[model samples]
Target: MITLLIIAAALVGIIFGVAAILPNDGYGHRPVPRSHVDSYPTHNPFL
Candidate 1:
């Protein structure tokens, strides 16, 4: 049981370590491109 627990912990740690080392591109907060800007209306009546 202890060995299984250790293996699980190690796997979790490795996953987090790898994720932490990778580069991020704004994490989904990137700005919209100029080309798609005109698709949405300047003013929305629903809002």
Candidate 2:
């Protein structure tokens, strides 16, 4: 019974640790995808 309680506590600790380590935008919004930004051309050969 004690071992089961310890296991459950360890699982909870791991979950909190993982959540803290994850990256987050200041506004709680995910950053735009790389592919979306690449769609707009930054340079033109004729320019």
Candidate 3:
């Protein structure tokens, strides 16, 4: 049980470290491309 807690703590630390090292695009996240969004069909049946 103690080992499990330690492993979980280590994983959380690593995740935060990686996240901190990632580039910030000012928006805080990468934007989805327009082609990806347009590929999905719209749900409006009345149109």
lDDT of 1 by residue, 1-47 (tens): 99999888777666544533455222443334443223434422221
Highest TM-score: give the candidate number. 3
The residue ranges of model 2 lying beyond 4 angstroms of the native Cα positions read 25-47
Error of 1 at 33 (Å): 24
* TM-score of each candidate structure, all chains considered together: 0.49, 0.48, 0.50
Against the reference, the lDDT scores of all candidates come to 0.45, 0.46, 0.46
User: Of the pair 1 and 2, which is ahead by TM-score?
Assistant: 1
How would you encode candidate 2's per-residue C-alpha lDDT over 1-47 as one tens digit per residue? 99999888777666544533456322365434542223323321221
Supply the global lDDT for candidate 1: 0.45
The C-alpha local distance difference test score for the whole of candidate 2 amounts to 0.46
Model 2, residue 34: C-alpha shift (Å)? 30
